[model samples]
Target: MRTDYPYDLAISDLREFLARRVTHSNVLSEFQEELDSSLKRKTVPMRFIFEKFIKYTNEHKQFVPYTKDEEDMIDDLFHFWG
Candidate 1:
C-alpha cells in the first residue's frame, strides 16, 4: 500500500496500519470496539486528564484540577512579577 496516495481510502488504510501496530492482532475488531466506546461518551476536560496523569506520575499525590490556560496565565504573571 502506497501511503502517500490521496483518497478517503488512503486515510482508512493508514488507520488500519496504525491499529495493527498498536493492537498487535485483531486490529480492526479491537479498534471498532474502542471507537464504539468513545462515540458513546463525552470527552473529559484536559484538567481531569492532567489530574489522572499527575496521580499516575506522582504515585497517588493529589492533583489540583487547573486547566492549561489558567496554569499558563499564572505562570506568566509569576514570571513577570516574582
Candidate 2:
C-alpha cells in the first residue's frame, strides 16, 4: 500500500532530529561509572563498556531508540549512537 510519507526519508529525518536531543552529560557520567567499576574489578573490556553504554542509553531514553526497520540504516549512519 502507498503511504503519504516517504519511509526512508522519514527515518533519516527522525534520526537527525533526535541526534541533537541526546544528552551527552548523562551518557558520559554513566560511562565513567561503568569504567570505574570495571577498573576496580580489573577486567576492563572496552566492548563491555560500550555495550553497557548502549543499553543504558536505550533504557533511559537519553537517546531514543529506533524502530527495527530503521536499525540498519541508523546503525550505519550513527554506529547506534542511541
Candidate 3:
C-alpha cells in the first residue's frame, strides 16, 4: 500500500515557509509592544497608530511584507479581546 504523504515537497520550500511565518510573527509581536506603549501614553488611537506604522514599515522590502488584507486581519485579531 502507498502512503499519501507529500514526498515531492522540497526542503527549500519548507524553509521558506518557516521563515515567512517567523518573520510575520515577529512583526506582529513588535507591533504589540508599540501598541501597548502608545496606549499607556494616550498619544493616539491604537488603530490609527497601527495603520500608520504598518503603512510606513511595509514600504521597505526588508520588513515584513504583509498585504493590506493581512494587515487588517492582524489588526482585528490584536484588538479583538483587548
User: Top model by lDDT, which number?
Assistant: 2
lDDT of 1 by residue, 1-82 (tens): 1223233332343344335334334534645454444335522123432343344536635344656654563343233322
lDDT of 3 by residue, 2-64 (tens): 122121222222233334543556655655565556546643243554464556456644475
TM-score of 3: 0.30
Candidate no. 1 TM-score: 0.23
Candidate 3 residue 6 Cα shift, in angstroms, is: 50
Better of 1 and 2 by lDDT: 2
- Model 3 ranges off by over 4 Å: 1-23, 45-82
Please give, for residues 1-82, the per-residue lDDT of candidate 2 as tens digits. 1123333443444434334444576755555565456546644334554466567667776765567655654444343222
The local distance difference test score of each candidate is 0.39, 0.49, 0.44
Give the range of the ten consecutive residues with the poorest summed lDDT in model 1. 1-10
TM-scores for every candidate against the unseen true structure: 0.23, 0.33, 0.30
Q: Candidate 2, 18: how far from true, in Å?
A: 20
Q: Which stretches of model 2 miss by more than 4 angstroms?
A: 1-23, 52-82
